[model samples]
Target: MKRTTLSIALLSTVMLLTGCGEESNQTSNTATTQSVEKEPAQKACYDVGETTSFERKDVTGPRCQWRSEHNFIVYSEDLSKPEYPGTLPVKPGYAVRRAKEWPREDLSDASSYDKPRIQFWWNNVSSRDPLVNDYENGYKIWSVKIDGTDLRLVTDDMPSTASPQTFMMSRSPNNRYVAYAYSYGEPLIKAIFDLKTQQTIQLGSARTKPYLVWADDSSYIYFSDGFKRYKYTLATGIKEEVDVPLSENTVIVDGKLINAAGLGVGVYDAKTLKRLYTILPEKEFEDSVDIEKRIYRQIAISPNGKYVWGINSYRKVLINVEDKTWLAFSKEGDEKKVYDKVVNISNNGRETQVGAAIITIKHYGSDYRYELTGKGRQSWKVIQSGQNTITPVLYNADANDGRFLEIENDE
Candidate 1:
């Protein structure tokens, strides 16, 4: 019973993990590479100075700093507000580079926790191609806190030919390590970066870019090279083969298996394998439109298995497993179907409050915010009266925190 890596096309459907920046004072540092077998050839490394900080004193546009007493729903714009001078700051670099179609940022893994950090690929060169520029060479991984204070170089040994869009990363719950993978030209390669030591441990290559998932305690990491699954122990440096069948587009919580495929998703009891709820996307496009455009991807289930969220060809979405209601962010749609109208919703049946959620909304030509506690849609609570919408390129979900990272809608 070998656990095979599920071929989840969530990222493929939507182009994920692209980065852009102007030019900054690039410092060169040698990266310490540790390989399981023969060590990789030593190469020049890149480093960000300890003095480099994007902290802004007067953040009049939008707020990017975390609020200790804020609502559950945290937006990327809000998180980047305190640090970023503008929506796309190209002066000091490290800000998202946008294209004419969409704001092009390294939509990789952006943290949502208290000390959230974001990781991305940067080449010290200032050129914006659709993917990685051909002339670029200094490909490296860099990370910084949301407030842009602690900037550190994760690794500078990324293959020059590696596609930036193919880059995928996940930070461990403990924030000690970052597991990342990307394709150089053909087959994919994966590795773990030590945040504390500022070094890298290169795992073997994978046929496909394997997904990185860390254990709750951050004891072990799970990934597949498209054929065999592996569990790498952080302390012992032991990589063991494992047989755990998992669907990339699904999650199991409280004995419930939630799977999102094609145009719909289903929730089933893991033991009985019986479906409990079937959620489908709203009918937004005309019937003559291609059905593939309506397919759902990046599906996520809440820790309690009560709710699910994802994105499709058009917009981000959400669903209540119990009610089987699929919600979409829309300008003109049904009151129940429009997630824009959803003030807040959270359910904790056993405890006094299981969870709480809020959505920044637009009502009657004004801004509003609300938090729902599973009792029903509550009254509009204006925690922040006027909020600006910044285009979000990446989202990282911290299941333990009961909240996911978000960016305001560009619309």
Candidate 2:
């Protein structure tokens, strides 16, 4: 909801594939007349020049791990940090743009293992008012490295009258492709990008609530708009709706899907849409809670599609996909449950480690406890000190469960 000046390092000679510098650069670039049947030439990755230093925002935003090896931040501050006096990452957000309530940036590691990169969105619009950002245009998708070089712009060619907004991304298991969705006024902008070539293809649109899942080989892109699931074959360009029933709390893994409907957790074959396994909540908790009537939301699946975590307003469920096992547990009687969130996922999409935060708000202060849970052959939990509310709710859980990397320097 808020816009800010982004300070990225190493962009002295970065080529602008689709620039948004000048006020008039909002013109749609072949996005309107483009036909879905035609395939564009694969674009070589943005040609980046020498590395440069920057001194932009003083306050850093959330930091994301790229390939679980490097860090990228979406910071915002009052000052602008320039490398060569004029080179800036993006225009700075006006101090007046700050609002009491607005959505913060939600970034995902959209990097391909072969070519390290991270994906995030830019909302130039500061308000719902048409005048804030040209209501006709402005929103965009971007990718950069953990080292802050090779800043490439995706989501060009947006129709001038059509606003390409509300983007959700799902990187393929192979890490070569990212399939995402955005609505252009009507229908939907369901597209996939080949990170290597920097080329994106629009397959089709969705009418209802749309969720995306990519095939392991990057050969197919699947999306469900609540009613039915559709599979679009990359080679054939054929998009056919499949007979898949979906609720709001379901997510598709590579070859399987995890759904928390009825009174149990259901696993299905993604290809054949066949039920593979079902896990009911433990009998001890079943007496107090009605799984059949409970609505599970905020479901988070690990990058490898091996572990599934789901939560209703009050309860939580953890599912081990490989073994078809699950656990449904919640805090005991009258316990204060302030917040919970999934922080860091595995870099290589394994069950090695996943990070999360469990919080309890007290009269004096809030308690922030971080957890790094291990799944698969190795299983353990390394915890962070949760003495006070000052503890950051999110932890960048790498192989080390790095603590200092994101900690602010009080000195």
Q: Best candidate, TM-score-wise?
A: 2
Candidate 2: where are CA atoms >4 Å away? 1-118, 124-137, 144-152, 160-167, 196-199, 245-255, 258-264, 282-293, 326-339, 347-411
Q: Give the Å shift of residue 285 in candidate 2.
A: 5.0
List model 1 lDDT by residue over 129-152, tens digit each: 222243333455555433232334
C-alpha RMSD in Å of predicted model 2 compared with the true structure: 22.4
- Residue 152 lDDT, candidate 2, scale 0-100: 39
Relative to the unseen true structure, what is the C-alpha lDDT of residue 320 in candidate 2, on a scale of 0 to 100?
66
Q: What TM-score would each prediction reach against the true structure?
A: 0.45, 0.50
After TM-score superposition, the amount by which residue 94's alpha carbon in candidate 1 deviates from its true location, in angstroms, is 4.8
Compare the candidates by lDDT and give the number of the best one. Answer: 1
lDDT of candidate model 1 versus the reference: 0.44
Off by over 4 Å in 1: 1-114, 127-137, 147-150, 165-167, 236-294, 297-308, 313-316, 320-326, 330-411
